[model samples]
Target: MSGVTRDDRVHVLGIRHHGPGSARAVATALAELNPQIVLIEGPPELDAVAPLAAAQGMRPPVAGLVYAVDAPSTANFYPMAVFSPEWVALRWALDHGREVRFLDLPANVSLVLADEEESEAPMDPIRTLAEAAGFDDPERWWEDAVELRYHGLDIFHAVLDAMHTLREGHVPDLRTRRREAAMRRVLRAALRSEASTIAVVCGAWHAPVLVPSAFPTQAADSALLKNLRTTKVAATWVPWTSTRLARMSGYGAGIESPGWYHHLFTARDQVVGRWLVRVAHLLRREHLDVSSAAVIEAVRLAQALSVLRNRPHPGLPEVLESCQAVLCGGSDVPMRLVARKLLVGDILGGVPRETPMVPLARDLDATRKRLRLKQSAAQQDLDLDLRTQSHLDRSKLFHRLLLLEVPWAESAETSRTKGTFRESWTLEWKPELEVALIEASGFGTTIPSAATAVVAQRTAEADIAELSTLVETTLTADLPVALSGVLAALDERAARQHDITRLMAAVEPMARVRRYGNVRRADTELVQRVLTGIVTRITVGLPAACTAVDEEAGRELRELIDGVQRGIGLLDQRELRAVWLSALRSVADRLGVPGIIAGRAVRLLLDAGLLDVTDAGGRLSRQLSMASDATQAAGWLEGFLSGEAALLVHEPELLEIVDQWATGVDAELFDHLLPLLRRTFAEFTATERRDIGLRVKRIDRGAGASGIRSDDTTLDHERASLVVPGILELLR
Candidate 1:
């Protein structure tokens, strides 16, 4: 087996990534050896930003972000936590003023060669060791062996020996070989340099092959890395989160319990006791009944379980079990809360303010600071009163980010009674959004500029509906220039657009902006003119659009008609309403119009007082005539009563017409129409449907002239007399 010689200048420390015990051991070993240089396993592209780790605002749980300059989304993160061994080595080297370098293949090459196939199957040394030790879980075994135990420098030596044995006859895949070659190449360079002593910190799996005696010649290492594909890569420091460090988060080197490891690293003594105390406190905060006595018992139980399991110390499993038993009373619900809030953790790290960032990112940071809106990992609800300048600006900023496809905030539903002056939003900042910001940097250097550019680009291809949405978004964002371009595109599209349904769909947003523009102090005259033109075009083409339609098309046209009616209500302009009502009348009078459309048109006319109750009853009676197709009659009823049945309850004439039609239908036709009729009535509230049912019963009993009912002589007077005394007492 390969091993480091006693007199060798290079000391290799094999470590588990993000392992607390490994991190502690690395710091201890580095202090003792005081190596002249330290090497860490990461992309070399990150070396430029490595010094930022020591910056004033620099924090752990941050990552070295590297990405292809041309394609920013093709990226990789080299994350470091407070308990990471490589992080310990890096800080040690930086504090001692020793030379430091990354030992893996450059990100530029790896990113370009990402698609290359592996030459062989990779081996899991940890799993192999765990199985040999009679443990099913490699993570638990490693935690017991290295992470939970304090082995100092000896643990690294043990890991190295075990890995050597494990890899005695194993052949690494091409990517693994190339990565090891890169480390070796970096090692050789450090050896040739003036540094007399070097410390290389890397994953344990690579430790055996990295020893100089394992592959003495440089030619093979050089051959593995020759003429590799490359690209220009940029690197920077960005904040990270503990949640993203979990294995379930799809990170390659993620750990199961970042928060647990963090607690282990930070607490100097009584690891299990401290952890249980924290759990007790968390449970208490959640309004659970956790007593100090329970915490102490939990600690005792954890230690006992560790001993029973033959563990040197209480590991995460023991502590978790103890907590579940004592603090939580075996309830899984509180434990889920513990796992999410304490185990995986919601901790978000920070980077130094002076860390390198794209211009757009910098601008946004400045804007956030100026607005006093601090970024947070936790979700927060923001209720903005747009009448206030600051709130308006904040709303605009969120809208701009949304337009640029950086969804840091999502628009939430607000109470309609709160009026147009208030907007609701949910804000949650994520670390990956930094990469998104980088991707959007090419658009412009500022938020407004980038958002405007995005709108302009999208406007060129936007249909009338898309353009209408864009217009509203741009108006809300308060981008006057982009709004102008979008309006022009909308007008151009609306002029020649033959799809009247699209024209109808555009009305609501246009009418909304025209009506609420005053709240934002925005000019709405242009929107008003555009809306008028759209309404006029809709009225002219709607009659023809309603002709020659199938069932699906008929349903769609009915919905569009409802939408246009709603828009006209929002505008509340007499001229537009008159024109729209006239159009509906034409649709009702036109031949070959779908029964649903004609029925809806008559209903709207009656609601608007353009048609009297008698006229509306005549139209309905005609639609439901004996000669009329049963399916057509059902469609007409569905379109008229699709949303509400209150009209039928109040308008007894209309109800009588429908009742007659229903009673007149043959049993066969009624059976065919039952499903359709049920679906239409299902849309109504229970109260409305009940009221209609009661009215129908009255009509059937021939007592429709009066709502009151006569007394019944068959009433149970003896049973009713029991409630009479109680009713009299309540009345008093």
Candidate 2:
């Protein structure tokens, strides 16, 4: 062997990452071995900062980061948890004053390999072996193989044998070969040193290959890493979280249940009792009913399940099953709460003040602190009523972060379906957001400036719709600095684009922002100015645009005109409104214009009082004449009177014209018009429809021919007075 001696052979402590049992075994084995040096599998580039893991107030669920010196965004994380075997091993070395080093392939090469190969490795021997053994869950198999069975130094030997057996005919991919070769090279160099006793800890899958007999020669391993492309890299440590660890985020070697493992690792006695107690605590906070009796039953159930499953101690599965059956009453709602809040806790870890971060990340952190917002691995719900200053500030911060493309918070919807007063957000902080924040440093130093820069950058390619959306986002974020630039972009896009539909689509959103600004008390004067210009253009082009089209185009233009009309109503300027209404009146008068649009124009004119009651009745009579096809006339009527039932109810002449049209239509034409009539009537409330029906019935009976009477003679005062006493008695 390259650096082997029979008297003091190097020990390979095989371990499962983040496994409590493995962690315990590693601590015990390291204590007994008393090695002068301990080498752990991590980015070798991060060896100098490995001691940070043991610093005062340092906690686990922390990660050692290594990134390109020139490009901080290109980084990798080797996360550590308190229950992690490697973490325990590192702490052991620190306490014992033993030299420790990270021995994996350097992060520069690994990051490149990772970026190049975005897909997961096709070969996963551990998962394959678990599947072949009829274990549907690989975590269960790992628990049985290592966590449940392994103890003392015996585990080391068992792991090596199992790994060797699995790799008897296995072939590694090129990336794996390079990685293993690097690990081997580091071990050989460590062994060749002056240290007498050395303990090497690594993944169980790599333990067998670390042996000198099974590993490649030192010279061969060196050749594979020599003349490699490399980048200057920096290393540091950052805080992580238990929820992130349990969820595994995207780490390949993550534990299935970090919370369960933590319980196993920390609780000295009454393991089931502690877990159930935590569950009860979580349930109580949510105002759910849980009691001591339930806890006792749960403990008993867990024990019984452990016995039934033939486990040496109650595992997570047993506890979960027991929790589901007894405490949950077979309901998953309370159980899910326990699983998320307790199993995957909301505990967030923090790094020391000395830790390094890019300028943007530092600013972001400062803002988070200022807003009293916590960074959690688990998703959290934030309900903000923009009426409050603090809530508005928080909202602006989230929007700015979004503009930077660092999705720490996302715009979500609240249960309140009716207004803009409330805003809901789902906040989840990922480690990679740190990298993204670092990348965004080139934009600006502060959140507002960076957001402004981002908007400016997007303006180069954004179309009118996109610019309009940006405008709304900017207004909501209260980024006044970015607003001018975004509006300029929108103006530029609008000037270049002549598509009326697109222009009209842009109009409504601007009007919405302007109106909402009134509620938020934001200065919407700029939006108003831009909206005026858009309305002017739309009005100038609309008369010509409304004429001569097919059914689909006609329908589309009608909808667009309707939206533009609604938007015109939102504008406070009378001149712009006058121009828009004039264009609509012209479209209504033009014979070539489609009946649907003409109907809408007439409705707008009537609503604006440009058309009198007499004019509206005449227009209705003309539109519903027998000369027009039933379908076309029905479409016009639907466009004109569908939404305003009062127009049909109060305007007797208009109602008579509609009645005549309906009565005069032949059976086949009536069939064709049935759907359109149904759709129109569907818009009216039951009372309005009932009143209209009664009017028609009265007209049919010649009861309304005499017109409405206001005389009290027809209503007998004596008879009515007699009924009042009975009505009063019934009320009492």
Candidate 3:
């Protein structure tokens, strides 16, 4: 049987969801047909709110939000832009006083079905057909064939024919079949109730299936959707953004460029001129040298490109190419600015204040307004200097939100100029985070209180390492109310945990947070007290932990020792510093410790002034003595001097000792020791390695004084005298 059959009474108006062309065509068709009942393919749950679209200040780029009453997180969005065909059709019905209603399956079934994520099918039949027809991108083909070329009934007919051919080779899953059946049942009921014709606006792909003559039997359709488990759902309108209207936000039927389409729908008469003017405005604001002349040239070039490409109007590609050539000087930097600001306009739609939202989301929005941190869909970079109270407050709110897993703000890398004083964040608001906020509302009423409650709950079962991370998050979030509980938990965990490696690993982050506390003006007395105890335990147990470890275990222990050394270096109390240095001295002198650990121990002792230069030299000689094999001597050398190139670079005596050790080892032993030596030297910077090599060359050739050249002797006096005045003039 044929996939589609014609019916005169039902005017099936197929449309691209957010296409400007489709919106125009649908509007024209609705005006011409003048149907009494308009059945739109939208969630039926939002039918009551449909009239809200006609209300004053009810803007486009807003969405009808439907979520399960039992599980608000199980939600779906049906977003509409100013150029959307459904939006246009609904507006027409509202203006003409025609009855308008949503005819698709309700959100109760859709949200449940959405929860069962289907595995991606290996192939798409529509994509295959587009490819077979020699179009690499199916969307481009759809635009060129149906959207860009047709109007009124021609577009609907073209879409119907294309979808019919595609569907002939495609077999939809049961879920799709059920949805279509439900839609058909609704349309049949509408036809029966309304004597006048009913106009159906739906996705172009569903037009063929919705025809009354081709629809499945009413009895079978009812059985397919009968007795399905459903929960009550509530819906409200929420603001959306142009960026989220793009396909990247995972909207199934999203458009590529909402800004461009909006222009096509509203400003089609002078799209190129207005777009170039917008670009020129952005460039002038950025202080780039753009002018009226450049704008005029860009318009001309866009028209020329359009004519060359045989297009009726200048498309996005033409405008972009013209922009790159005329205004950007063939450089992509200015063009990128144009694309970001103009092509993807940062216009965020607004819903009526009376729209319903979960308490957490409502509270979050209020707090955001109070903090002057406006929510936007576009990603914006924010740099905060902790010295400022407002910036600090913004940072704290972001951290708290992160704790709740809202993920609206992400901490970026530290700023380059002001290291400790500044923090950076990339903030982008996603609509789905409303669900996360709803889930977290069970904790507390506000972001700060909720974050504190959450941290306290997690701290109950957290270990020392996890608690260490939690403490840093709490500090960054500025949650002083929860700090005491987390600190107490940390102290209790630290008292019970005897693993030296874990203790050492946890100390550095805690110490860093404590150090940052002074900058943030946050209370750090508990952190300081906890860190002191942690340091004392690490100092006492480190010597024992270093004993009898294998090479791999030695590497891990070495990292912990390094962390401890760095942590102790940042401590304020002199008594603690003395104890840490004493611990290092003991570890250095101990027998049977891994050579790498002993080397680190000796380096730390030397750095702390516990060992003089003479003592260091004598220790190096003994460690590299002929009594030990090349492997053992190499290991010892690697421990003390692996990452400390400055000492060797400046001190010839240490360099001479290393040279003697290298000469003393036999070729096979040297070959066996090459890897360890290479590993040790690899940590040094390139200049350090090169300088060391040059110093060694000087020592090997005994030419330190023989090759010295006087700078004055090489100068040409007459030439220098001639250029001195010119150099002075240039400098002045």
lDDT of each: 0.84, 0.78, 0.78
Each candidate's number of clashing pairs is 0, 0, 0
lDDT per residue for candidate 2 within 1-732, as digits (tens), equals: 222225656888876677676788788888888998899988888787877766776877888878787787788877788888888999999988899998888888877677665543544455666688765445456667765676667667776777778878977776667778998878888878899888989877777788876767777777777876778787877778776685443235765567877888898789898999888888788888889999999999888887887665676778898888877888998988877777777666667655777777788888889999998887899999888988989988988888888999997873423237788999988777777777788899888889888888887778887787788888877788778888987787777778767788787778878877865668988888887888778887888887887768988988888777776776666897889888988888887877778888898899889999889888888878999777778878877884668887777777778887887899887877877787777778777887776665445313332255235447788778997775333223
Q: What is the TM-score of each candidate against the true structure?
A: 0.92, 0.83, 0.85
lDDT of 1 at 579: 94
CA deviation > 4 Å runs, candidate 3: 1-9, 34-36, 48-59, 67-74, 93-99, 115-151, 192-197, 227-236, 248-251, 283-310, 329-333, 413-421, 629-632, 642-644, 669-672, 700-732
Q: After superposition, which runs of candidate 1 have C-alpha atoms over 4 Å from their true positions?
A: 115-124, 131-140, 146-150, 247-251, 414-418, 663-671, 701-732
lDDT of 1: 0.84
- Give the winner by TM-score: 1
> Model 3 over residues 78-101: C-alpha lDDT tens digits?
888998888999999998888898
- Residue pairs with colliding backbones in model 2 are none
Error of 2 at 35 (Å): 3.2
